[model samples]
Target chain A: MSEQGPAFDLSYVANLARLELSEEDVAMFEPQLQGILSYMEKLDAIDVSGIEPTAHANPVLNVTRPDEVCPSLPVEEALRNAPKSANDQFVVPKVVE
Target chain B: MSLASQTIKGLQTLLEKKEIQPKEIIDSVAEAAAVRDGAIGGYLGLDQELAHRDAEEISGGVLAGIPIGIKDLLNVKGQPCGCASKILSNYIAPYDATSIAKLRASGGIPFGRANMDEFAMGSSNENSSIKPVHNPWDLERIPGGSSGGSAAIVAADEAIAALGSDTGGSIRQPAAFCGCVGLKPTYGRVSRFGLTAFASSLDQIGPLTKTVEDAAILLGAISGGDKNDSTCLDESVPDYVADLQGDIKGMKLGMPKEFFGEGIDPAIRASVEEAAKQFESLGAEIVEVSLPHTEQAVAVYYIIATAEASANLARFDGVRYGYRAPDAENLGEQYAKSRAQGFGNEVKLRILLGTYVLSSGYYDAYYLRAQKLRTLIRQDFTSAFETVDAIIGPVSPIAPFKIGENASDPLAMYLADIYTISANLAGICGLSLPCGYMTPSDGQRELPIGLQILGAPFDEGKVLKLGHNFEQSTEWHQRRPSLG
Candidate 1:
């Protein structure tokens, strides 16, 4: 393992994932996250200079569906599970002042 | 024999012959679950009225009247789909997943909510926010997970068969631990429309059944083209049940040397090797092959899967359906507070690791490199398949451990998935069936060992045939666990 590995800023990473972690959570996860990152460093030794990266296992390209109209989930059914819904729309906290 | 103890095929025969009623079977299983599920913890919810209603209308179909367990990770329209996590604790699926719709159309009643590791994130069921599913073979040990409850219920006869999603051995490992047959189809073989995503690329829905034939039946029914999930292939799905009787004569089976090396339980290795010898006696050639990139599978899987997970789970903010923390100042606080409160430790850890790997500064070095390595892993299988019709190995390196044995140690828990992770990475199909059981020298309860058969993409017919032949030659699948 090299000292050049990312410092693994736990709080910064949590915020990136949209997770709010208490200090206790950060303390607990920091070392474990570092261990996993160092373990992942094993991939650097393999010379994959010319190998193509596979995003999906199947060879699917430009899968376009026809523009024909199809029945979709009804708005009421879709919003039925929303924690806060009114007027057939999901109500979210106001972002702007 | 107890009707509840019968396999899906066994019960189907009786149902078709009018010797036993679907209602009777459901009642017995529901009753048994009511009496025995405390020790097993298999079902998160069981709807008796719905089970009865589904049983009342059994007809002439492949899976008629067979009660199948639905893993909580799958959406069973109008049922709670918690994924065994607190985040979605109050969530109710408004529609059936493609597989569930198919199962219902086939007259296979989706009976109950089977438990799983939260968001299908853990190797053991312990990470479940609901409850830990116990191994039917030994209550103190884990039913290997995140498909733990699906395996446990089938093993305990609480359900004739069950549906489970495998992402890094969730289906196979638990099935092996619980002494049943489990299969993860080739990537895109089954539609993943309603399955909550843990890792979209690696996650696949599969069947956990009491017998290979039942697994074949369920797999065949639930698989095919679906417009909803673009990953599902448009290729024709073969009748897996009808194709299960083929002989393996002259077929080449590869035994990867990496699968048998150090860290594997000696007994488990010997058992899997013996299974290979059994294949030899069945006139199949067993060749020793090398998958050099095997060791890096777990490392690459964690990085890629978690990276995808971090992205996928971003949808579960407090705004839409699911659990939302109250008394938040605004949307941002709501998002963080809800996620932090809702997720379990394993989920949180993976999210953190995933976010780190995909974070702007580290994305190319970690995520891209892992994806490249993933290509190498897939090539290993593609090349190996060129020489052999199928590959054989142990499902897990060791038998099921005690409930909390690896709970505190994430790496050890991650290592439990080493043998099963490669197939997912390769986008190939694999099956796990009981090859043998090993009783420890210290006189602990005997544990089931699985023989994993791997086939090329869309080679489920070959895999199921091999499993059927192997099962016919041994008594391992016929053995039942006597649960308290």
Candidate 2:
């Protein structure tokens, strides 16, 4: 994060991003992030009042399928990418006690 | 030249006559890889058996028997879709991405996993955590990224052509640097279902090939409506190859003066100006147009792209699949550690920047403001197309630099995509083809510079026609890097 980021709370933002940074990463990235964020500040000068935000370049109508069960990835294949799996379910750290 | 170096049209003709078997094309590609990949480091993996299986199963698709390299991000069933990052290094794709399925249906065999910047993040291939792709033109210099491997290998003849995803200049910049033909189709022109998401709005899958005609063929194969990707407009895919004939007589080409302004390499600008004159000679009218919002393109792209990327990448949390940090006592620690350890530095920086912008009290200022600027950027194109049939410019401001030259300077690196990023923002088709060369004074050998042709949304046929005509007239696309 940038200096403003640290001032505004980079750890808070990192926690939001779910990325843990090492001391080296923070040290190396801080000045760089500061530079990038400062560059992004250039956007502030533009008067974009009343302009609509474009979420998609070519926005499509909400597509509705027939909702029929199409052939989906088999359970085994779906689980194939999991780092920890059993019984066709991903095993993960406990979410609840 | 080996068969692998031949254009798709050349190979397809021979295949039609039984002059060469499909497997032989795969064999040629394998041979090229053995000779060239060791030096270029363009491929992450190549399975001969898979290539042969694809070749054997060919059903006379349009690009029959041709082997096209697959960028690591796109899913090929049972193949690792690493996206050139360690996070998903162990993950094998469960099914073919729509583009791959369509390409396979066209009889183009997916040959190898080419390297890329981790999750298609950076301007140079140096961002690849797996291995950086070297520019085949000059072994020590960097191939532009995140489609660097796709472009490098196509230039090196390791694969007949390759699939590359362009979020912002991933395909075009690398194509310019490595001297290959790269096309970034209009956003939503090609489905994004199977390809790893970069920024949903800006992300698109296109081709990196040896010729503009080859790009046309591949673009034809992969583009169409997909049930899986809603944004893939129901707009019909045209016969891009058929549009290639006829001179560009009386066609209007716009040269945006903002892009040609100071800070671009004089040599590159001269080459493009020379190309504009060439286009004029070929009967196209070159007109000066202004995209006033051009200066804000890079800034807006970083904000909107990173904001979306922050959201898209949230799926990588160590849960259902992908790399999981070992020995996490809690889910929070797991998410943090997995991303920190799994991603490279640039990825982390972008995520942090994105997360910050989207964070409370800041979202309205940064992300929203950038989005509004994006609309103005798109309007610039809409207005430009009113007078010009297509826009022409240099792909990048400068030639390919040496490895580590801008590695430490992230902002400097981001600025390199200045010429290419707005096309993505505007959701238009853009093509990069060789126009001229930069002969270095130091005897380091000459490097290739590319001329970029951008067309209106779903106007790929027009751009392809323009690029193909130029390619047929000039000998630049014919020049290949000499392999020892």
Candidate 3:
């Protein structure tokens, strides 16, 4: 970690985000991201010790729907945009290997 | 005037009178768009045959035979809702978004696919993976984005009116840049059921139109409670068009000192202040109000919006829909490769920023603090509302800049959003209409300037009324760009 910058590793964060970035992306984005993070650091100066964080603008309660079944997308329509599908199921690489 | 250039109300009246058939209007618009949009690049595609057929069937609906442009972000059933990104280029919407359903029921023909910033991420349309949208007023300048194409198409008269999603000023800023009327309804005022999510908490879909009346009419058509979008308020939708009349007598308009201060371009500040004076003449009182937390809006927005964006966008993985990277060694590699290859630079940067802020170690320091600041920002508006009915300011700090000017500097682009992001953060409604034009230092040509009118949550009627009154007295909305 640098003395004046964030301690978080860029590559580590990118990996967690499931982003595959090249070395050039790393070199270019490191300082840029660092600058933005430092800019956001200004938030620390204002005293927010007592204020509760607002997760959303409106007050929302648990939204529930009736349990009765309704018409859903037909199998063909649901599978229309799938990159790889067979037998109306999305095909994926074997995870158990 | 050409059928394409007419406002929604004008076209609707014409269609109802049977003076012009819907097919003729679509054909005229299609021809004009083909010739002009080649330079403006406002549309991704146009389906005139379907539009013609749909138009012919409609008789006496509210928008009868009037064609409307759908932002590529909104799903119109059986159309390509690309969102102007390569990732979703081939993705066809299997069903209509609830907003589209309402529009169709009102006799609106969703005709053209307008371009946008990739996944609605950037302030300039330059971020579009397909092509950059040019401002109709000056082709050399950018149409402010992520609703760039929507605003540009409306200004150029390629679409009678268009729907745009505003998350951090995507709709209004672009409308301001392109010299049109753009409204962002309160967060829950309009259903977000069909619109692609950017910052789910802040995103709301609204209309970009040539006139305030057109905007009001379009807003009324699409807004109501929806069973699909739970966040959509169940409150009754007001008759915005009917509310457009009447004087602004005894109404107090607040001018936020922070928005009119040092960073604003002198010309834009003058134009907006002049519009305020016009409101004063119309029996409205102008009062100076302070939103002390205004300075913190952009920072708070970047954090919260991007955090929500990261979560909302995670659904675009390779398996179920959209693009999937070929030649991936494993599932993990596939997810990473597909996203990295599919998304544009701005989208990736935002996603990274979001992931970083929401990361374990930094959550309390960045995201949490930002949320706390968000509370303060909302309080500032809530407190100010007690003193004034609405707030007005410059829509953007500066006039439209040359395309590719700020594309390289992300921070500069983010700072431009300072004036417009607060309403979204506060969950209030805001409108931007052409107030005046400013000729640049080069003296080449004048660019349109927007005056932003803001109201409390669900106060869209007030905002539109004020805009309607101002627009009635000004020639700004009447001036059309001389597109070459």
- B429 in model 3: Cα distance from truth in Å? 0.2
| lDDT accuracy of residue B265 in candidate 1 | 91
Root-mean-square deviation of every model: 1.3, 1.5, 1.2
Q: What is the TM-score of candidate 1?
A: 0.98
TM-score, per-candidate, Cα-based: 0.98, 0.98, 0.98
Model 2 per-residue lDDT tens digits across residues B289-346: 9999999999999998899999999999878778899967998999999998899899
- Model 1 lDDT tens row, B296-410: 9999999999999999999989888888889678888889988998889999999988988888889889899989999999999999999999999999997888889777678
Where is model 2 chain B poorest over a 10-residue stretch in terms of lDDT? B438-447
Candidate 2: pairs in clash = none
TM-score of chain A of each: 0.90, 0.85, 0.90
List model 3 lDDT by residue over A1-97, tens digit each: 3435677588898888888999989887887787777777766679999998987788679877888888989999999999999998999888785
CAPRI rating of model 1: high
Residue-level lDDT for A78 in candidate 1: 95
lDDT of 3: 0.90
Q: Please list the residue runs of candidate 3 whose C-alpha ends up more than 4 Å from where it truly belongs after superposition.
A: A1-4
Worst 10 residues of 1 chain B by lDDT: B438-447
